[model samples]
Target: MNITILYFARIKEVVNYSSEQVSLPDEVETIIALKSWLSNRGETWQKLFSGSGVVRAAINHELVDDMATFDEGDEVAFFPPVTGG
Candidate 1:
């Protein structure tokens, strides 16, 4: 399946990427699976996606937890916590 991933805030800065189009393997069918897969890329990615502090996610502009599932053509976004006064 194919999807668009968007990075925001600190995530964007850390990954040095704003967005990307990725084609997933069959086993990568959930948000959690996707994160684990990406984490396998290398140390940089592993540190970003793995560990205790998992960046927040949004599927199609709506915030969702790890339980959320995605499909072809989905738009997924990852970002660090946001705070404003």
Candidate 2:
């Protein structure tokens, strides 16, 4: 499926791009699956996406959990947790 993946904060710097269009293989079904898939891309990908790391995600601008389902043309975002005091 086609999806737009966005990076924020340090993730953006690590990935070297703010966002990119990706065509995910059929095997990827959820946010966690997507993270695993990206981690397999290469060193840069692996470094940026830690399987057990605490990364926040949003599907179509709505914050979602790892179990969230996504479809073709969906906009997915990866970012660090936001903190304010």
Candidate 3:
């Protein structure tokens, strides 16, 4: 599927961009899987997405859990968890 991934905060710095479109391989099925796949791409991707670091995802502007499924043209964003007081 073709999805748009938007990066935020420190992740944006590591990826060097705010967003980009990526074509997922057939094996990728959920948001968590997508993140794992992205981390496999290269060093930069690995660092930002490595381990269990806090990252938030939104599908088509609506925030969703990491288990959310995606399809073609879906906009999936990866960002750090937000905090406000």
Q: Give the candidate number with the greatest lDDT.
A: 1
lDDT by residue (1-85, candidate 1, tens digit) is 9999999987898889999999999889788898898888888889988756659999999999987999899999999887778
Please give the TM-score that candidate 3 achieves against the real structure: 0.85
Sort the predicted structures by TM-score, highest score first.
1, 2, 3
Candidate 1 Cα misplacement greater than 4 A, ranges: none
Residue pairs in clash, model 1: none
Name model 2 segments beyond 4 Å from true.
51-53
Q: How many backbone clashes does candidate 3 have?
A: 0
Best candidate, TM-score: 1
In angstroms, how far off is 69's CA in candidate 3?
Answer: 0.5
Q: Rate the local accuracy (lDDT) of all candidates.
A: 0.89, 0.87, 0.83
Q: Cα-based RMSD of the predictions, in order?
A: 1.2, 1.8, 1.6
Error of 2 at 60 (Å): 0.4
